[model samples]
Target: MDLLNNLALGFGVAFTFQNLMYALIGCLFGTLVGVLPGLGPLATIAMLLPITYGLPPVAALIMLAGIYYGAQYGGSTTAILVNLPGESSSVVTVIDGYQMARKGRAGPALAAAGMGSFFAGCVGTLILAAFAAPLTELALEFGPAEYFSLMIVGLIGAVVLASGSLLKALAMIVLGLLLGLVGTDVNSGVARYSFDIPELTDGISFVAIAMGIFGYGEIISNLSQSDENREVFTDKVKGIMPTATDLKRMFPAVLRGTALGSALGILPGGGALLSAFAAYTIEKKTKLKPGEVPFGQGNIRGVAAPEAANNAGAQTSFIPLLTLGIPPNAVMALMVGAMTIHNIQPGPQVMTSNPELFWGLIASMWIGNAMLIILNLPLIGIWIKLLTVPYKWLFPAIVLFCAIGVYSTNNNSFDIWVVALFGLIGYGFIKLGCEPAPLLLGLILGPMMEEYLRRALLISRGDWSVFVTRPISAGLLVVAAILLTIVLLPSVKKKREEAFVED
Candidate 1:
């Protein structure tokens, strides 16, 4: 009954005329960015941060949220149509989706992606609505010790879930933690690592960092690659709706993907990228049905599962950000920046103090999902056309936008230099087999973790045992320990590596 009332209140707020329009606009923009390779929601949202300043907080958040899940919807289109993943989560979709398109089953494959996304998105939102309150209650019970323990679990989870070398991921986290230590010390009223630069006093501009690492970094990398072998499906799409047999094969895969994605999204550092990869890997491990196409061929289950998981994971990634004031990924970190700009602190109090913003955002996701399904199905051709635009033309405009966007944040030229510096660093990461996602997670969590650690020690008269003395904190640490133990086991480590191994 309380849940119903909260949802009703949320709907009442989200259904407002202004919010709906912004949601639509956001969804449209999200699809545009997602349809084009080398663009992503993180960079788009960072570039658009200035625009959100003037709007009502609820409207701004609704639109940003729309951009996120809407990207999930559009990403599959490019993957199926061109064998290019418009978003990282869609990388798995290209394996089978492009094959289906090659076989002239593009329309049915796209339909499966759309339907799977819609269903999983709805389920993921429902899970968020049902579990958010309970999670908030649990978060409310946490002390500084528990939070510190939880962050450990989160960092370790990132290492465990991240692809490529565990050593690289851990090194990135440490680097991020070091980077986060820049700026004025919270308690000491002194600068820690500012090196006497004024702009460094506030630490790094997250906008510059995000735009550099994800936006400019990506552009540089894409420019370095040869576009000679790129393929675009110009063949006519036969049918926009799935056949009866196709639907039967897809339903169970969607369900399983939704379940896996929803669960993973709530974990630390888990998001669409991890969920899609996991879902696709799981589907391949399942018994091959009689007469079913092989996993890398034109299997409809391959199309459905990762698409569902991607959407589901995208929706549920909000849990940690909203309830615990932790960002599970880079996009959520930008959201934290957005909320800070609006003077709205994210955490347990948000539900009680700002019910409309919290619930309205939730309500807007459902509406946005519906809008995406309606928009994607009919406008498939338009998105397909977008793939033909040459990178040379597109990348310069993106770089310009990123430069202008970074400058607008603080009206500082130094920030532009920051973006350039990090662009090179980001490209270096790409060359070094390192993942930046975990680094972003660590950077966002580092300051908060330090604060909590200090507060916990202060409360315990500098006794380190306080973390292990509290039952909840101890249990969280135990869980982190167990996760570390399992990941370190030789058999489990090999399987973990193999699960993420790219063919």
Candidate 2:
């Protein structure tokens, strides 16, 4: 009954004329970006941040939330239509999705992604609705020690699960932590790593770093690759709707992916991105029936699993951000900015003070996801044409948009320069065979790890045992340690070797 009441209140808010319009607008634009390779939700969102300032907070968030999930749906379009992944999370989808497309079963491959995403997104949203309040309560009891331990686990999870060398991931994380220490120390009214630069006094802008690493870095990497081999959309494209057989195969994968994603979604750090590949890997590991579809040769389950997992993971990620004031990833960090701009405190107190926004946003996920299905399904014919755009033309527009977005952040050219520098750095990372995603994860979480560590020590009079003293804190740290150890083992090393070995 209480849940019903809350949901009812949410409906009242979400159904408002203004909010609904924004949702449609956001979904439309989001799908546009998703269908284009080398462009992503982060780029579009950052560009729109300035524009959204004029709208009411609730309406603004609704639109942004729509864009987030819509991008998830639309991204699958390019991954299936072309070899290019629409987003990092969509990377695994490409392994089998493109194969299905090549087999002239592109309709089913895309339909599975669409249907699975919608189903999983709804389930994920419900999970968030049921669990958010209780989770926030759990977050409230956490002191600096608990937070420090949790952050430790998050950073470790990011590095351990990162696709490349664990050593490189850890090193990147350490560098991020060091960079985070550049501003004025709150403990003492003195600057530390500013080196007498005024902009350094406030520390690096999240916008600058996020845009630098993800937005600009990506452009740099894309430009380094030879476009000569890139495939253009051919006349092979046809009806976008799936056949009856296509729906039959995708259902099981969707259910399996939903379960995996729901569980993984609660974990900190890139759970959305990880769950997709994890589901794909699991599907491959399972038994292969005689005459059953091969793993990478047009398996509908392959298309279904990762899409469902990623969408489910996306929705559940908001649970901690809204309830606990803890941002598990960079995108969530932006939400923190959204909340702050609205004068929301972003802690457990948020539930008490801004129940409307909390419940409204939660409810809006269901609507946003439904809107995506409607936009991406029967309407997919329009999106397939989206893949026809050439990368040579598209990438330059992205570079320009990123440049304009970074410039608009502070109305300063400093961030533009940073983006160019990071673009080169990004290209270098790609050339060196290092996964840029983990570096991004490290860059985003580095400062938070340091802050929590310092605060925990301050509360405990500099006694280091506090992290291991509390039950939750100790458990988390132990998990981190175990994860770190597992990544170092010979077996894991051999597995990663095989991934690149075929190369």
Candidate 3:
């Protein structure tokens, strides 16, 4: 009943004329980003972060969140139809989804992806609504020690959840931590590595690095491929919606993915991507046994699991962010940035001081998800047609939008140059067989790690053992150590090498 009242209050705010319009706009823009190659949710949100300054906080967040998950919905269109994945999470979909398309089952595959995403999204929302309050209550009890421990857990989860060499993931994370150290020392009042540049004193711009690496980097890599190398789907779309049998087959996968996602989503970092990979692994391990359609050979379960996981992960990621004010992943980190921009400090206190923002954001999540389904289902046919567009046309336009988006952030042309540089680096990573996701995870977690590390040490009077002395912190550190050992083992290294062949 209290939840109902809060939701009602949220509706009152979300359903207003202006907020509804932003929601629509967000959904459309999100689909566009998802349809394009190279641009992911984080880059999309980061680029537009500056533009939302003039809008109301709730509406702005609704739009940003829409784009984030909306991409999850939109990415499958490209992956299934054109064999190009818009984001890393969608990569597994291309494995079997494109196969289904080749068999003239493209229409069923697209419809299954959209419908499954909708159902899973709705289920994920319900679970989030049920669990958020209790989790928030638990979060309220956290102190500085617990908070620092939680961050350590987040980093561990990120690397544990990342695919490819764990050593590579750890390397990226360490690099990210080092990059994060470039900014000013809050305690010493002295610049550490400013190199005397005023801009360097503020450290690397999140906008610069994220936009460059993910946004511009993707575009450059795409351009490096030959025009004839593009993947194209048949112009004839098979169907607009899935039949009844399809629904029956997909329900189980959705449930399984949702269950997996809900558990992993609360992890500190790599929630959505981890959930997607985990969902795929679960599907593989269980062996849908070529049961109905054969798993990964255009199987509906293939579409449903990852979609369910990604969406559920997107929804549950808010748990840590809203309750603990600790963003588990980049999208939630952007939300924190958004909230901070609005003069709001997100924490356990946010639920008490700004119940409207908290509940309203929660409520808007359901509404935005509903909007995504309504916005995406009918558009699958249209998106499939996009595959018919020439790579020459599509790649440039994508590159242009990334450039425009990055420039729009600070109205600075320097960002455009940075985007190009990162594009080169991104392409290099692709050629070198290094996964960029861990690097992103590291970059996102670096600053927080630094802050917590410094604070924990400060409390312990510069004792280096503070991280291992506290019970919670020690436990988390131990887990990280175990993960490192397991990942670095010879067998795991061999397995990681095999997976890179897929890249």
User: Cα RMSDs of all predictions?
Assistant: 1.5, 2.5, 2.7
Top candidate on TM-score is 1
RMSD in angstroms between candidate 3 and the native structure over all alpha carbons: 2.7
Look at candidate 2 and give me any clashing residue pairs.
none
lDDT rank order? 1, 2, 3
Q: How far in Å is the alpha carbon of 205 misplaced in model 2?
A: 1.8
**Tens digit of per-residue lDDT, candidate 3, span 1-503:** 98888778878888888777887787778777777665667766766666677788887877777777777777888788777787777887787788888887778787777766777677777777777778788777665666777777777766766666676667777777777778688877798887886666766666667766777677777777765755666665667666788777777888888888777777765767777777877777774544477665777778778878877877888888888888787677677777877888778888788787777777777788888788787777666666667667776766676677667766777667767777777677777766665666566567766676677677788887776666766776677778767867889768755543343
What are the Cα lDDT values of the candidates? Answer: 0.86, 0.75, 0.73
Of 1 and 3, which scores higher on lDDT?
A: 1
| lDDT, candidate 1, at 181 | 94
Model 2 scores a C-alpha lDDT of: 0.75
Please give, for residues 157-254, the per-residue lDDT of candidate 2 as tens digits. 76765656667777766766776677888778698888898777877665666666666666666666677644644455565666777676677778
TM-score of structure candidate 2: 0.92
Name the runs in model 3 displaced over 4 angstroms.
285-291, 463-471, 485-503
Counting clashing residue pairs in each candidate, in order, gives 0, 0, 3
The list of candidate 1 runs beyond 4 A from truth reads: none
Q: Quick one: best lDDT, which candidate? A: 1
| Model 1's TM-score against the true structure | 0.97
Sorted by TM-score (best first), the order is: 1, 2, 3
